[model samples]
Target: MPKLQNIIVLRTFAIIAVVLYHCYCPWLEAWNWYKCEYRSLYSFIFETVLVGRMPLFVCVSGYLFSHLYLDRGKYHEFGNFLQNKIKRLLVPCMLFTGLMCLILQLNYVENIVGYGFHLWFLKMLFFCFMTTWLCAKYIHQIKLDIIAICISIIMMFISMPKFLGIGQYFKYYYRRDSRDNGDDAR
Candidate 1:
């Protein structure tokens, strides 16, 4: 599939936003929220990125997927594609996160398994592909392209709030988020 220029531009900005957040976000640590450096500015930037960054990546993914498989009617080849993703994305995700768990010996094994440590995005991508393939394969009544779009929309509706919260949640931590942090944090 040919790359979309707008997607490439969005991806470039998203990468820059992630780098900036990690390097300079005011909430350097999670202990207290209101006492951070750039309370308003960093939170605003971070929230804006949170709202659209990953969704942009997923939208580009859907575009490429439509071009490669759905547009080309390569449904028969989906098995190979899924296997490739398992090898390329899921296998590496498990291996690396498992290694980290082994080395760190953290009690939060669920975290490693559920979220894949620092590889969460890759794991999520793998799941996204799997979900798309499954929906396409089983729900043969609907056209693959339409089904894919519908499913993606549903996913966005369900997932957008969580990602948004991950960005803006810190801003409310001192008041609301902290109340939830009562026992588990210690």
Candidate 2:
């Protein structure tokens, strides 16, 4: 298979693994499958299936971007490349976000938060591509591609904590009224 095909397969598998974990883990809890306690096997499966997926995805993204960099030669075609990338990324993001927002507003869906969370990936990828494009365009002194990749990795690590924190915050706040104590004091 081609490299692009491999990348697509890897990314699709990662996304499927993550989504499956989210979907079925609650069923495992509901069934009391491990005596309501954590198991090493469960931990292993979780780590194998979900924990490493995003790293693989990011690595694939970096590999693809490297190929793009080689093809575009870092200097001449950067603007066109950046514009094409932004259009590809942004158009779908805005359409989906707007559509979901409208559906939630009209139907009063309680899972709007869950549906809307996918936009975070779109936004992050857009920023990553934009940063890579800028480095390719202006910062042509040194090997800026190396700098861009390193910066992307660092940003991903730093952003992971913030992402988890935001998820936790929303998880708590959305269910605040469902708490046993009914304490509104945050």
Candidate 3:
């Protein structure tokens, strides 16, 4: 198959944007005369590119998966598909997740459920794809996108993410609190 240069380029830029948003901005601090705050221009950056990139990546991923697998009638090779996902996504996720936990341990970051480590994105991707695959294979009437979206909405309701708001500013896009460790006593 011929490579789609636009998606490849967009994916690269999106990845860079995500990484840059996660890391500190030295130039912004220098401009502020050395007050390294997570606000002003930094907040603008977070609100824009950082907020957009992940969802964009996921959408592109879904599109590519459909184009390659569904278009080619490769769905019958379920064993090969599972093996590929395990090798490509799961193995690296497992390896890096352990390292991330170790780093967090060294830094004394406390949380229950291992806090999913930094590679939680990988785990999320794997679970999402596999869950969709199982749903499609077993329940053959519904559209996959609808199924995925409905499941996500249901999970959100079940999880009650509003009650778990991670950010203090309430106006932020990310309301799910990341620091909660199951201790209401704290």
lDDT winner: 1
Q: Residue by residue across 1-186, what tens digits does model 3's lDDT show?
A: 678798888788777876775554443342222345545777567655465665566656756676676576665567887888778876776676557567645332232123344444554456556655676577665575566556555544343322212211121111233323411111
User: For all candidates, what are the clash counts?
Assistant: 0, 0, 3
lDDT of each: 0.53, 0.50, 0.52
- Residue 45 displacement in candidate 3 (angstroms): 1.2
Q: Rank the candidates by TM-score, best first.
A: 3, 1, 2
Ranking by lDDT: 1, 3, 2
**Model 2 stretches with alpha carbons more than 4 Å out:** 1-9, 22-44, 71-76, 106-116, 138-186
Model 1: lDDT equals 0.53
**RMSD to truth, every model:** 8.2, 9.8, 7.7
Write model 1 residue lDDT over 1-186, tens digit each, in one string: 565788678778766655665554336332232245546665566665454554555566656665666667764567788888889877886678778677768534564445445555566566566666676667774576576566445544342222312322222211112223211111
Evaluated with TM-score, which candidate comes out highest? 3
Q: How far off is residue 68 in model 2, in Å? A: 2.1
For candidate 2, write residues 39-77 as lDDT tens digits: 566546765546555445555665678666766454247
Which of candidates 1 and 2 reaches a greater TM-score? 1
CA lDDT, candidate 1, residue 150: 64
Query: Would you list the clashing residue pairs of candidate 2?
Result: none
- Tell how far residue 9 is off in model 1, in angstroms: 2.1
